[model samples]
Target: MAIYHFEAKMISRGTGRSVVAAAAYASCSKIYNDYDGMMHDYTRKHGCVYSEIFLPSNAPPEWQDRTELWNAVEAAEKAKDSRLARELIVALPVEIGLDEWKAILKDFISKQCVNKGMCADVSIHDTDGHNPHAHILLTMRPIDDKGKWQAKTQKEYLCKRGDEERGFTAAEFKTAQADGWEKQYQYKVDKKKLYMTPTEAEQQGYERVSKNPKSTRYGRQNPICAEWNSEEQVLRWRKAWEGVTNKALEQNSIDARVDCRSFKECGIDEQPTIHEGVSAHIIEQRGGVSERCEMNRQIKADNALLLEIKKQIKKLSAIVVDKVKKTVLDFANTLENLRNRYIFNRYEITQNENISTELKQYNTTIDVTVQRYNGIVQQLDNKITELKKMKAEQKHLNPIHIFRHKELTEHIDKTEKEIKKLQNLKSAFLDKMSCKSEKDIPQY
Candidate 1:
């Protein structure tokens, strides 16, 4: 099955993570971090299927090299708590070929990161056939048209409108005289074998210019509008990976598709099972029973129970339908026969005063028939409700179990519909029985 798994994290200086070391491990190569003057060599590491750097069109061409690109990022960020890179760990569909996986990763990076002025370094790893995944390292800062790093945040001065002391600092406001903390500047100019200040030059009618400086209270620094540091943006990126992976699967004519939605969001009632990671899978393959393997065994058992419940529901539904049909037919026939008998014997009964007894007997028979019908209806209804409750319980099982029992789910749905129709028919029949005239009795 094609599973969906995408995790994102930050490589930050505050956490003591080196982007160069991350890159070395992902690409299985040696790289030097100019920021710390340390060599990150992982040449002995294996299972690196592909690795490449993708950049925006305006970025430097040399940045395509892993060492140069990350080194430049390291040099650009100067703060001790600066974020070095954004890392995305996504699982690839092992059912697809290596080339297809690479193509999918490329498409995802090109649209989600590179097009947004961020450079992406992608690496695909498939050490064993069971575990195939990719690691993407993305630059957090935007690049300008000149291929230079742009500050992730910029300071903005806030000024009050229509105030005499607008933009004045707190200290400047307190020390202001009657003039209200205004700026003053002096400029000297040398012309015609004489030196003159800006005021003197202006008095002489010479072209002179003075500078005006504005005051501002403590400036506030905010992140650039284009930065992807929010939870919402992370969700969008994860969804984008799902789309890319599904598209690749479709292109390769694979039946499987990946989804990034939660079980509730997907309209699935089942709880998702814990992921059996590569290590657990390897352990189980070697004839070792790991915890995950045991969980999987229990999941299989739950699935079997789910299927059995579905089968029981179907069987019980058929039996209820047969019983209801027979009861309705028998009731209708008895009502018809009684109506005919009463009409035929009406002439003889009119001579006697015992016609009331015959009518009472007829009512008694009708009452008995109704009781039997109601009993069957109540029993079947209880069984139907039981089946519904069982189906609801299945929702709390593992999602893998639900996915595996799709056919059983459909069967449950169909059985429920049939039970609903049976209930409606029974109600309609009972309504007809309550009619005042014998001719109104419903025919089954």
Candidate 2:
């Protein structure tokens, strides 16, 4: 799922140093590298001082036009005049494949500016985690002098003056000014609320900017704390609570995914804890697959291997049988040639009645050669017969044959034991599918 996770800070023109400007610079240097030729488009489509141009209602137009948002933020030394500089922070989803993140920022500014009754001046870009973010620069002074805002502080007026008059060097002054702003407009925290506390609301899981502890029953100041009385109890508590947090996080994530609300509005107070729990559960579910799926995958892989083996066996058997046939044929031809030579030599011996001693010796040599040829031809016949038997046995020795063979008997037995596990998974899925009402289904 796509998410926008970002934080915005108000910078002072007097100080010249700005967190918002730094964030912008970082986005330019890092984020711009991803989409080729998108930087120029980003500048044109979404004005450079994004928040001021699109979310016009977020900040007063006169405030940014006179102050020059970029110039004020670019200067590092000028301290921010909280009295004259206001910023609104917001995060919203901009899917990865959607229009460049800057475009989404423009649309969001248009909607939120009108809703909040402020002028729009926004800056938005994707973050390191691929989450998009927006920064809004707002006018500290009210549009109408007698509106909700009454008057501006002298310090704010001085910072608004030209560069020569605005010297940003006073850390102590800035701190005191920030502190005064909080005292006048601090957030109100109600203790009896069962939902989240003020501390939770301020966290918002943005950058670590907001900090104000709320009063709770388990506040740090409590004299005595609750703990398990014994080690055994602690172990029991750990086991019992282990799955509870995971269940809550999973349910919360599902709600957050479907609901159009911020993290705070979604009832998530401890972001880190919830994030960890949900991640762990997802990993666990994936690692431990259903027995039915596992068996199915294994069976498919084995069947493919068996098919390959059978093809190889068929090719090899053809080659062996052909070689034996050729060998037998060659021996038979040699035997025939030997018999013809023997008959010719016998006819010559019979025609010469008064044979010489040398001729008699030649006759004996011919006789022995013929006998050797007969013996070799008989051996070839026997080898051919053996090859034919082996060819017949090949079909019986196929993979199915081997799988059921005595050698693999033990393995087959174990596989049968595992079949029940897959059956159980199928049964459970069927039962779940059959449930017609919520009451019929099991609860956590």
lDDT tens digits by residue: candidate 2, 84-110 = 334544444433322434544454445
lDDT of 1 by residue, 98-133 (tens): 999888888888888888788999998988877799
Error of 1 at 166 (Å): 9.8
List all candidate RMSDs to the true structure. 30.7, 41.0
For all predicted structures, in order, the TM-scores are 0.54, 0.25
Clashing pairs for predicted structure model 1, backbone only: 167-215
Count clashes in each candidate, considering only residues at least 3 apart in sequence or on different chains.
Answer: 1, 25
Worst 10 residues of 2 by lDDT: 219-228
Q: How well does candidate 1 match the true structure in TM-score terms? A: 0.54
Q: What is the lDDT of residue 55 in candidate 1?
A: 85
Q: Which stretches of candidate 1 lie over 4 Å from their true place?
A: 162-227, 275-444
The parts of candidate 2 lying over 4 Å away from their true place are 4-16, 19-52, 55-104, 114-117, 127-129, 145-150, 153-444
